[model samples]
Target: MLLMMAEVLAFSRVSEALPNSTFWQFLSFHQSHVEWVGCSLHDLIQPSFSFLVGVALPFSLGSRLAKGATFGALLRHTMVRSLILILLGIFLRSMHSEQTYFTFEDTLSQIGLGYTFLFLLGFYSPRVQLIALVLILVGYWAAFALFPLPGAGFNYTLAGVTPDWQYNLQGFAAHWNKNTNFAWDFDRWFLNLFPRESTFTNNGGGYSTLSFIPTLGTMILGLFAGKTLKDNVAPNQKIKKFVITGVLLLIGGLVLHLTGVNPIVKRIWTPAWVLFSGGWCFLFLAFFYGVIDVANYKRWSFFLMVIGMNSIAAYVIADGLGAFIGNSLAIHLGQDYNLLFGLPYATLVKGALVLLIEWWILYWMYKNKIFIKI
Candidate 1:
């Protein structure tokens, strides 16, 4: 969550400020989303967030059960939470629009769309979860593979893709190409069902509501990790399991990509992407789990903990309040204040100030025990 906030609040501006520096250039590459294919640090943010949701489920369910919550009660709460998350996502996306956007491609909405299924799976055995994961990935893959590609006379321009666009995949992999696959076609029909200023043609980034299916796969992988953590295994064994699983997932994703069986496109949340990104999620969990939980070296993470504990608040502030705060800073501090460091670094200066204010807000919330949980 801190990373997600930082990417918007400060990282992009800082990267822009140091355009000629190799270090910042490297950071900038990861800070921004890739156009169509492959992964960037920025791309991992959504998957990681989704994965952690699954990781938390085991603990959440245990607590609820221990509190004598019945299955019906749990189901009711999950449904309400899912609805709120979906509406919250739509609300956030519609913040600058003329009306409610009614898009389900937002991260929160995508997760919400799949959360109930994930919640139900949380109650089942690991074997069932694994089988479901396989079925989802394969079934989604087949659906796309079976969807007819655009015919020769089909106009790519209408779908926001140029005929000669460099990233357009060829052959079998084209099934997952941007704005030209099953999901894109589904959106054309599905999104148009909602009221709109104009007909919904395609998502500029090629993200689709159906991506939630594979996103559930990513979450299932996290569910496995969560179950592992809850097991009565030794710390070293847990770390080993995570590392092995991470490597295997990475290999599996790469093999599919290399063999042209599937492409690792994050935009559509392709099945291969579920495996690839899930690998990174596991490794990250292992690193943090080993460092903070296993080694008891928790002091250094308090700053991050402040934002992470109140993540929903942090997300809301980052997405909704950032421009407000930035404009206010300019209003009160003088428009030229950020230029004190020089014109090139003006964005950096302003962004840093905004980020600081955001952190302070989170810190205040932390101090007051005002976490905004869904």
Candidate 2:
């Protein structure tokens, strides 16, 4: 959550302050996923967030079931929550627009698109969920592999690829190329079904609405992890399972990419990307669970808890309130003050102040026990 909040502001500041700086470049690498392959902190945000939703499902369902909630009631709640998330995503993306963007590629919208399916999976056994996960990945892969690859004469430059781009994969791999894929094509039509000021051509980032299909695989991985955590196994045994599972996922994802079967591209949320990101999510969960849940080291986690407890509010504020808060700071502190210490340092100060204020708001909400759950 902190990473997502600070990412754009911090990276832009550093890059603007020190153009062509290798340090900023490396930091930006961590802040954004590579276009074709590799993982990073920023890329992991959506996956981890979606995965955690899956992680929480068992507990949520269990709590409701314990309270004698009916399946019908649960389904109704699921629909409402999903709708809320989708609408909120659209609202956030349309903040500075005249009309709704109607985009489904945002993290909230992507999650919302698949949330119902995931909720349904919560009732199934782990074995069944694993099968569903496999099916999703394989099915998505088939869609790509079965699609016709762009011909050799096809223009790459128009699609943002260098004419001499060497990373271009051959055979079925070309079907999964950035802008010229089944998913991207489907999006060109699907997104156009909504009101638009202009005809939809392509997502500049190469993201597609259909990426949610493979994203389901990431959530299913979380379902497995949540099941493990909810099991009657010992703490040490659970930790071992998590670590092992995480390692296997990482290996599986990399093997696919390295063998030229699939490239781990997050923009389209490819199957390999799902496994790779899901692996990191599991490892992250393992670390936090090991220290706090297993070792009972709770003192150092208070700060994190404040943000975690009201994550929805934190996310909304980060996305929608950033500009307002920045401008407010500029007014109070004077724009020149930020540049007094140098543009780079000023950028850092402004970002830090914004984050601090955001944290304080979250902290206040936490203290008041006002968690805004979707």
Candidate 3:
């Protein structure tokens, strides 16, 4: 909750500081996903999320390992969790829309699928897991770039494709799930396969299908992180090594770009993108490790740690409450109360109020221990 508040405020502040009407434009830039062939701070969000999943795995699964959980127990746990996440995503996407049709391809769904794969990777040895990550990345790259786009056989370039494949995929997803895509949010193609998410390449399904790869990489890194925390490695040495390694990965990612292998496109999930963002994730881990663990700055991290402790809850609060409050309150206030405040400040005030409302919602959840989980 705290982190969400801070992140949202930082976003709005960045937008506010822009000159002229650039505030709106910059705000859009921050809120909107990046186009193909580039990385943005926004792109970091999903990977960070995936990384968080890995961070939790050891703690959660370690308990299972300790409690004498069998293979059957682990499989059941994985399946149930994935389904819950997937369904939750679909439910969130469809919540306020017309009830005539159902929707698919939500973040929850991706997280569900992604988490299942992440656990599987974490279940294995790090060496094998790393190899799997490489295969997934290289394989997806080949699938999107080398293989022709469906229905455009022998033509691989995703340029000028009308109606994103995601729509078609959702259409299929809706059918399998006994529902239909909302017209406003997606195309109504029937039985569409592989609903696309943000693509690495244009239409490449940004971390969509390809996410399983980097996601595994993210988990692998987390495993190392868990091991670090568990092991007695000197804090100072770990911090130094982490800083140096992160810097090298960042630099190496850049050097690869200079050599013209692939641009650092987040949409396409280029290997370079993985190396770069994954490097930054390492840096983030280092900072938090240094501060919270090494420096013992527990007080400062407490708020984020609260939200981080229930990170998934924060995701719902940050987005779910933001949308629900913003839409309903902004409309009611602007349409009904604008006569008093006038249009100029009425909408702005409503937006601020909505943010406050979301904060309170999260705060309430935190206080009551009413976190919604998968």
Candidate 4:
């Protein structure tokens, strides 16, 4: 979560601010997903965030159940949390805007949209959860696959996509093409139900509300991982399960993409992407669990634990108050103050300062035991 937050609130902006060089350019690329084919580190952030929410759910559910909370109470709590996440997502996207954004493609809204289902799955056995995951991935894949593909002579230029965008796969694959998919069509109808600055068209990034379907699968993978962690197994056995499952999922996703059965597109949240990103999430959980909980190497993780512990606060403040902090710094310190090596570096300095401020806020919260939960 800290790494993902840093990418959004720090590295991406810094990459743009730094002078154009091989290393910086590479950093920039890693900070953004490939146009239509492959994933990037930045692309994993949302999925990772969603997956971690699932990973944490087992623990949360266990606590509530142990406290004698009824299933009805749990369901109600889940609904309320889902509502807050959706509303918070919309509110955050509307930041600095004149009206409510009503966009459900943001990470918060996407998670919110699928969170209740995830919570429901948390009560089920691992076998049921696995079946649910398969059903979600397959059902979502079928939705796009069965959607009629754009006919021949369809003008890509007219669709606002690149004239020669990659992976214009024919037949079923074409049904998932950028800006021309079923999800995009649904967004036109769905988003238009609310107020808008203009008629809802396409998300500039090729994302859609329907990505939540596959995102649920990502969370399910985490749900399974969480179950594995919570089960009464040896630490080594649990870690082994995580690593092995992660590797298998990674290979499975890669094979699907390579064989052209599914294209690994992050924007549309393809089934392949769910497996791919979920694999990475598993690996990440394994690494962290092994290092901190298993090996007891706790001291080095203190800084990260601060941000991780108060992720929502960090995320909301970074997106909501980040620009204000940067502007304040520029106003008081002078715009030229951030110009370390050159004018191009100004944004880098300002972004770094903003990140520092965000970290300090998280740190303060951590010290005060003020963790904010949805």
In model 2, which residue pairs have backbone atoms overlapping below 3 Å? none
Could you give candidate 4's per-residue lDDT for residues 192-296 as a string of tens digits? 999988877778889899898899999888888888888999999999999999999899999988887788899999999999888898898899999999999
For candidate 4, the TM-score is: 0.94
What's every prediction's RMSD, in angstroms? 1.2, 1.9, 7.8, 2.1
Q: Which runs of model 3 end up more than 4 angstroms from their true locations? A: 1-32, 96-105, 148-210, 327-351
TM-scores of the candidates are 0.98, 0.95, 0.73, 0.94
lDDT on C-alpha atoms for all candidate structures:
0.90, 0.85, 0.58, 0.84
Estimate, for each residue in 49-115, the C-alpha lDDT of model 1 and write its tens digit: 9999999999999999999999999999999999999999999999999988989988899999999
Candidate 2: what lDDT?
0.85
In model 2, which regions exceed 4 Å deviation?
19-23, 152-171
* Ten contiguous residues minimizing lDDT sum, candidate 2: 156-165
TM-score comparison, 1 vs 4, better candidate: 1
Deviation from native of the Cα of residue 200 in model 4, angstroms: 0.5
- In candidate 3, position 186 carries an lDDT of 24
Pick the winner on lDDT between candidates 1 and 4: 1
Candidate numbers sorted by TM-score from highest down: 1, 2, 4, 3
- After superposing candidate 1 on the true structure, give the runs of residues whose Cα lies further than 4 Å from its correct spot: 9-19
lDDT of 3: 0.58
Query: Could you give candidate 2's per-residue lDDT for residues 33-62 as a string of tens digits?
Result: 676667778888889999998898898999
